[model samples]
Target: MGRPAIEVQGLWTQFGNQVVHKDLTLAVQRGEILGIVGGSGSGKTTLLRELIGLQPPSRGRVCILGEDIQRLSAAEQRRLSQRWGVLFQQGALFSALSVFDNIAFPLRELRTLDEASIRDLVMLKLRMVGLRPADALKMPAELSGGMVKRVGLARALALDAELLFLDEPTSGLDPVAANAFDELIGHVRDGLGLTVVMITHDLDSLATVCDRVAVLADQRFIAVAPLAEVVQLAHPFIRDFFHGERGDRVLRAAAQPASSPGGA
Candidate 1:
């Protein structure tokens, strides 16, 4: 296999005297959706920030798409950053910008496309994320929770980057909307041939969409495997997480056979 799409070696994150990650190491394969799950304060978000160069780690090497981010010059890092897209936890849309402009932001930053071309690309991305072209004129304030998430996803895809980092992508949606969003994520990943790293607390998402799940606990990743295998680990967190009533219900639902359309 080629080099991993993302690699972390002996990673450590410290704030004052508190250490969040210690000797953490991980590798994400190309074109795979890797879900990160951890309890509260397990530093899941911190790890995501570190991966995207938003937060620096006290000790460790982070290699993204084969380049070490810590070693990159500012200009080089800026260029490297364009190779991946990030969907922040809250969608992070500019309240002042319309949806059209939000998705167009990244494309416009390139400064190579004409207005007509930018508009065309923006509309294309909207359609790609299951949004109507007419909806592009609406501001973030006018959008529903699911719409906000879709807009954020559309903006993330505007660059056509090979990597996507999603921080709590389905956090605020209802069950139905969250399921639809999960389906959209799988569709987009497969359609774009993208490598996805998602930090999600949604069990249904981890069960249905993730190719593999990474469990974060006690300051590092305890296990990284397919959900089935990870749930089998003997750790207390794994037991509490997967064997709990809600977790068991979700897993049981995930394991059942899909009924055929129009079947009894």
Candidate 2:
């Protein structure tokens, strides 16, 4: 509804002779959840790294929250980082740290908070992600797959970021857990008033959570629109991605007649 939270103009990223993205331009509006999807090796993660300032683009500008990220000084970049958070493909929690410490990591880096305040903030973050207080004492290795994801999410939200990035958030969970996680994301987004940009291959997730989807191909987004509108497109990749065999299954499921109470 407001201005763009992220703006990329003429973004070009290259790894030696392989160009991952070329002239890629897009703007992610504030308070929206946008999913980016493409075939394997379509540069989803690469694009995320570029946006987060981990991977610098060979050409073009990346602006975050109205400021040109690439032009910012070291100190300014660090300050801007506090406004956003990212959950990588596999949670990526530090194995050496307990869940509590992982959630507290970013807060500790601020070096301004006393231990008591840090504990209180960390507990709040854990609750926001649906984790229990007892979980704080467990190391990453002790958590189950779903619990690990929640802890990573807690750590990501620990800084109270308005913008969130998720890379395959539901990748390893069972269908039940995946659906629950999707609902959790929706709840958290609306509850926190956060802007989320996610890179995911889960179609059900797109149908359930994303407000819009950006389909990447030929080194650029061929379409960025609501799932309903984008799924109707005839583009080869877009059509197959949304209406192919797997997509057909999703569609078929959606078309199934709902059973009446106690009736087959």
Candidate 3:
């Protein structure tokens, strides 16, 4: 296994009188796809935000790529920010920008590439996400939900980040599209050697792309292990989650051996 790409120690988060996480500790290995799962309000998103420095833990340390993000100098933070990309739950594209320009936004903001190079890169990203060159001319309002997600993914990968953060990457898609999207994630993970941290309610995603699963419960993670083992955990939530009807079905499908398994 590679060195830890993300490390959190003694994490705590609170809002008003509500405590979300308490004393959570975790380490995500490099090049691994880790699924963050829990019941509706288990602090899954909170933890993601904290790890990415969007929200500060009331008490804890978050270190990414060996630098404590909270402690980094402004210049260091800027450089670190370039190392990863995030796909929000909703496709948060700028309505004013065309699809191609949205994909190019990061490159324009972060690098010195000229318009020609940027256009070439944007085209490549569009193709990488299985989007047509023609789709680039469409507005965000003109795309389907799945296309919107793909565009968001293309934009996230625009800068060639080493790490990718996805919030419910498959939510709101039909089963077939969701399945294809899962494979796409794995495709990019291997092709780009990217470490992926995804927060999802999709059990099949955990089975399909996640190398490990982290279950958040009781204000912290109950376990972080391979899906097979995580399902067998003795916690009530874990039992109810994985042994439930839908979960059991998806997990069974996931444990099946693939003849050519190449996608995420």
Query: Which candidate number has the best lDDT?
Result: 1
Q: Could you say which candidate leads in TM-score? A: 1
Give the Cα error of residue 87 in candidate 3, in Å: 0.4
Candidate 1 clash figure, as a count: 0
Q: What TM-score, to 2 decimals, does candidate 1 have?
A: 0.95
Comparing 1 and 3 on TM-score, the stronger one: 1
TM-score of 3: 0.94
Taking the tens digit of each residue's C-alpha lDDT, what string does model 1 give over 26-109? 999888899999999999999999999989899999999999999999999999999899999999999999999999999999
Q: Per-residue error at 71 for model 2, in Å?
A: 0.3
Q: What's the ranking of the predictions by lDDT, best on top?
A: 1, 3, 2
Candidate 3 lDDT (Cα, whole model)?
0.87
Better of 1 and 3 by lDDT: 1
Candidate 3 lDDT for residue 200 = 95
Residue 85 of model 1 has an lDDT of 91
Candidate 3, residues 1-264, lDDT tens digits: the string is 545888899989989899999999898887789899999889888888888887889988999988899898878887898899999998899999999989999999966999999999999999999999999999999998889999999999999988899999999999898989998998888888888899999888888778888999999889997887788778999878788878868668667653222222
Q: On residues 1-264, what C-alpha lDDT tens digit does candidate 2 reach at each position?
A: 556888999999888999888899899887788889999988999999989988789999999999898899989999999999999989999999999999999999999999999999999988988888999999988999899989988888988998899999999999888988988888888888888999999987887777778999888889987776777778899877788778876554434442111100
TM-score of every candidate relative to the true structure: 0.95, 0.93, 0.94
Model 2 RMSD, rounded to 1 decimal: 5.6
